[model samples]
Target: MAAVIDERPHYRPARGIHPLHAVLLAATIPLFLGGLLSDYAYYSTFDIQWSNFAAWLIAGGMVFTGLAVLSSLIDLARARGRRKQALLTFVLLLVTFALGLVNSFVHARDAYGSMPDGLILSVIVTVAAILATWVGFSSLRVGVTP
Candidate 1:
């Protein structure tokens, strides 16, 4: 076989987020999702412990989300360009964090009282968390435009 000429354009080096930051961002999804699941279990079974589990899970998710938001901010500040896209992901994370906080509060109420509202908030927060994670990860590239 004849050797073929290979050619490619050189581009700027890729920069990426810290591994820990990525872990924190990834962790937010499952915890929030778990909270949503727990809330649903409580709703369907009327078992109070499930709500308690949801509260704790929400609290954990908030912690991870808060860290992820801060880390993303640092990453955003360091990177030039792509502000609009990054900002959208950042906003989604912020919304998820805020809703998770509120959900935690709702879960603090008496088991019966926290029901529908807590369940609803859990759903919202979980969706937001997933959106945030998806946008953040999907939009990031090593050395290319997102």
Candidate 2:
């Protein structure tokens, strides 16, 4: 038996997003989810403090979402083969940020009045965050796996 060496070039696609963008984008999910849980707590317990927690969490989520949006825009412009996926991820992050802004405003109202609507917005924002994260990550891969 003769020893033989097989030579095959491995193909690796460029990363779809920068590491900082990924970190910022990943941060939004937990923050928004926290906001949602806080909203639910407020809704269930009717406590004003939970609204405050939700507001702060939403604000934090917005901060990260905004950063992610900017980074994604840069990624979109830089991307070559993955432009469409990058654009979709950017749009999703933008939508999440916008909804989070609205949710923050809703949470700013009187604790009692903010309910239902605030909770509703929280749900929407959380779902958007999840979808954005999913789409962003799912689109990162280039080829079929064995």
Candidate 3:
């Protein structure tokens, strides 16, 4: 039993980050930003409505990404040497979702420029992400402690 448990490692087939993950990440950022811009400035300045499209795209992308992140988190926890990546990915995805929620309100603002909403959100996300990454990396080094 011990020999089997400690045998030389061999690669096992499994799913990893697919190409679609990158596509989703790329699409979400621009879509959410554009949505906020249109809601706050573009529509007011010009007679147009782009928010509906941007909002839909951003929402769909984030929902898909959130699920993917959760799946990867589970896989990473089970796979050797992949846990840190998984935890960080989960945290980052969460931060993106948080920012998206904030941006949704920012778009509703009448005086968007006067407020530093974007900067504040960036700082909040950055701090939260840094903490999450630190905890995750440290756990990887320490192993799963009881």
Q: TM-scores of all models?
A: 0.88, 0.87, 0.49
Give candidate 2 misplaced runs (Cα > 4 Å): 1-13, 142-146
Identify the candidate with maximal lDDT: 2
Pairs that clash in candidate 2: none
- For model 1, the stretches where C-alpha displacement exceeds 4 angstroms are 1-10
**110: Cα error in model 3, Å:** 8.3
Error of 1 at 7 (Å): 10
Q: Which candidate number maximizes TM-score?
A: 1
Per residue, candidate 1 scores C-alpha lDDT tens digits across 50-79 of 988998999999999999899888777875
lDDT of 3: 0.49
Q: lDDT, candidate 3, residue 60?
A: 60
Q: Relative to the true structure, how large is the alpha-carbon lDDT of every model?
A: 0.84, 0.85, 0.49
Ranked by TM-score from best down, the candidates are 1, 2, 3
